[model samples]
Target: MPSFINNIVTLALASLVLVSNVAGDKLIFRNRSDQVRWIDFTPNTDGTNGIGDVRVEPRQDVEFSMDGYGPEWDRGRGWRGNFRAHRDGAPREYDHIVWGEVCFHCDSQHPEFNTFDVSVVRDPNTQEGIHWMYPRGDPGAGLSGCDHFPCSTCYVNSGDNWQTKTTTSNDIYVEIRNS
Candidate 1:
């Protein structure tokens, strides 16, 4: 009877520690529903409105890269995978979540011609949201940006059918948190 009681207490304590540890490291991704469409580059170019560019400032001690997964260019257009960070010259996998937002762009002669999906990646290790800024409406304009972590590069595929214009350039910003 005494041995059984002791075992139960030990199990309960162990479970509590495990639960707390897991909860502490968990991260949540917040998707801003307000989709801002850019119409003109000159006036709308700012962080206040539109899908901004990716910018990583100073760079992070560790660098990570983004890869897209799933059907080439079907419904899962923004499904990103393998955001690997470097540690001691080796790649380490960080737990992350991807959320979506809308992007509006322009073409040669047409105004407000293209619309696509944008995916934002968040690292569970850091509790900061990535910040991006771009002049509203101009998808082809140069993007100015910064981030908490150093972002080396990002790859985007314009699905399977269209390969003419798939990837774009932008500044990436990473937000880092101690806790």
Candidate 2:
């Protein structure tokens, strides 16, 4: 009887951990540059839908929240995508970022947690630009990309672990700088 009771308690604790891991997250994008920019999210090949492009003006910000569940996709469970910034009349920028990306109950080794990251793997206009992102209040928890073409903190390749994962609720912040 004691062994059965222990098993029940362990299952309860595991369920709690899973709930905390899959909870929704809030994202805040701040444009500190000198011009307005539009941010677009291209969902991963998983078929998860995302909101339309977001517009943030200079010295301004926008907040978005997503439930880390449902909206079934081809391969994953939650909404996942890469956000790219673009100028009004100019071309699309290559610096990209992602937030609230998790494949629920997948990848035991990685533990599907709400993750965020910035990348410059395809930075075409790397001549002069800076992009960074991190969980609010914890600058050390995130990374910056495109500061100088191929920054080590940025995801320049598939082997990079620039992505930040969170188990607790927090605000993810992103900043775009054009020079």
Candidate 3:
């Protein structure tokens, strides 16, 4: 009888611990940039679904709570990533926008979003960046992909260019802004 009582107490204690964790944990993001940007998420915690593209307006933020992780020892590996801006423009610029991406790599899983350590960047050779810039405001770290795609072939468009730039953080929430 005593052994059965101890087991019940153990289970009750475990339930309380799990409930406390869920009640107290949450992820937060702050977007301080002036332009709209996109963010993507890949959680090792949940291997089933990919958190798709997220659009964050300037000075806005978003967040997610930590869902229960997979049963693997490596679940919830750290997350960090690159940024990009896309919009209508010359053929090369448009093509650059369409192709601008930073891909995450994985094993036994589809590749995830590549995390970053250094400042936000635009590498033409790697074909990744937030390369879209206004005629007046240019961050300058972008692909000259425009040089390759003829401006004449792609109709020029004066539409809003959207981008997603990531700042550094721990294994939890990630900042989604250039600043």
Q: Please tell me which predicted candidate would have the highest TM-score against the true structure.
A: 2
Top lDDT model: 2
- Residue-wise C-alpha lDDT for candidate 2, range 65-118, written one tens digit per residue: 645423454223345566665665556543432222322334445445446666
TM-score of each: 0.22, 0.65, 0.39
lDDT of 1: 0.27
Residue lDDT tens for model 1, 1-179: 99999999999997774333222111111122222211111112222222122222222322222222112322112222112112222222323322222222223233223222222334423322323333233456423222332232211222312212222332122222221
Q: Each candidate: what lDDT?
A: 0.27, 0.57, 0.34
The count of residue-pair clashes in candidate 2 stands at 0
Residue-level lDDT of model 3, residues 28-112, one tens digit each, is: 3445556665654434343334445656667776654433322235333322223233321223233333222221222224322
lDDT of 3 at 118: 18
lDDT preference between candidates 1 and 2, better one: 2
Give lDDT for model 3: 0.34
